[model samples]
Target: MLAILREITIPCFFTSYLIVLVLELLRLLGRIPGRGLAVIVMMTVGLFTHVCYVLLRATSIEGVEASMLATWLDWSLLLALALAISFFVFYLMRPDTIVSFFFLPAVLALIAFAVSVRDLPPFTRTEAVEVWRNVHAVSMAGGSAAVLVGFLAGVMYLVQSWRLKRHRAGSALRLPTLETLGRMNRRCLVISTVAVGLGLLSGVVMNLNRWGYVSWTDRGVMLSLLLLVWLLGASAVEFFYAPASRGRKAVYLTLASLGFLVLALVGVLTTPHGQAEKGAAAEPGATIESTTATTVIEETTP
Candidate 1:
């Protein structure tokens, strides 16, 4: 069992999901016998392998860090796992819906991104700050997943609305009603906002504990603040504005929230947001000096 578990790799689940995706596409072409059963079976295999792979990585004793949340690669994989599970849930809830068409691609993309960044170093956290760091990571990842779902729901709502307007009710593609999609979007917005807000707060605590001061100008920090602000505004509108929460307006909010999330993710990738270099624990004096030296070097490099 240990050997089999150890053999589980990214390709294990990736291939399963890829096959499931092909199955889904095949469904669009024509009816195939046992297609739904095949999808469920493949998804189960993929999800099982995915969970095992994550567990192995998180518990491996050969690495400097045993926790899978210690690096970007692991973080991305964790995010993908969360999304894959979500897709599974959505599939079970509405077996006939095309939500998987949108979800599988996102999961694949995250896995691919994780592969590309596998060389990155793990974050270095002191024992005191590790708990808060975990909180920040989990909240951020969970919030990002919610935002992605909300964005997808918004897109589906728009497409469904367009189909209804065009009298395309006879179309082959089946989706939830606008009201259902809108409700999903609204709930996702609320969940994402709360999760990301908690993430940001935890991050602040982690930063203060590690470095004694937060760097407001850091790209990741700036982008996160911007994302949080937008989420807060969107959530306020969802609560206070009666009309905004139920129609195209609500969908637009989720779409824009996704945009902000993309920007924040870009900032994290392009800059060292949570890597060892940025997250390494240091004395307050040494941290300030290091920050100053880094700024000086950057300014003088060109």
Candidate 2:
């Protein structure tokens, strides 16, 4: 089963990526055919491959069906997949743009990274604080996904501005209108802020329940706070500077948030869990606020 999955998903992902790269090169040289069908096809195939790989990983685990990889790795995969789906929906609604060429590389690279690291080690929820842990993980995953969407919007903003700035009016590319890109970028920022806020609140609850106090100083916690600050700053800039701020300027600020997201994800993945092999020992006597959360955590941990 593992062999088949690796053989198929890996090749499909790589091939699709190559096609997208070629398409990008053509668009850059002013040879754009202006249709996004090829990239869209590639993304859909890549998505299918991504799901199969994840499902195989889950099924191979002894009993924990939901979590089949290390906590960080699992979270990364979920975030990446969510971002890919977001791209698909956005492109479908507004196709025939050079925007696909720019963002598809990130999506393909994420999938390839997932395939490469599928064998590191399976992550299982420790017995202690399972409910809270799941809440933390899911919220973090959702938040990261939101950040990814914001990043995409930022990239689109740049491409649109570049075309406008260079006065390449004769180009065949059918990028989205400036109005659409600006609105999308704004929506992405707002959605990401809300998602990250939930993640932050959940992290605090999980930490207090696990260690008897909030992990206010943990590097991971600190970095997440920094990321929240970055997102909040973007919101403030957008809200108050609307008169002065342009789509391109907003894109620059949004792109800056990428660093914070990366730091936050890596910080959590590499945290010193007690049972290094299985994410250290779970903290005991943790609190659970949601019944659905409890089921998810129990189901995730073996």
TM-score of each: 0.51, 0.48
Q: Write the per-residue lDDT of candidate 2 for residues 215-264, one digit (tens) a residue.
A: 67777778888998889888778766865666766677778877888987
lDDT per residue for candidate 1 within 1-302, as digits (tens), equals 89978988899999999999999999778889999999999999999998888777755634222233467787788789878988987798689898888999999999999999999776654543687788999999999999999999999999998999999956788899988998899999989987998799778767765655678899998999999999999988876688734578889999999999999999878876755564333456456657878999999997
Q: In angstroms, how far off is 44's CA in candidate 2?
A: 47
Stretches of candidate 1 exceeding 4 Å from the true structure: 1-125, 242-245, 278-302
Candidate 2's C-alpha runs over 4 A off are: 1-131, 273-302
- Cα deviation at 199, candidate 1, in Å, is 0.5
Question: Which is the leading candidate under lDDT?
Answer: 1
Kindly report which residue pairs in candidate 1 clash with one another: none
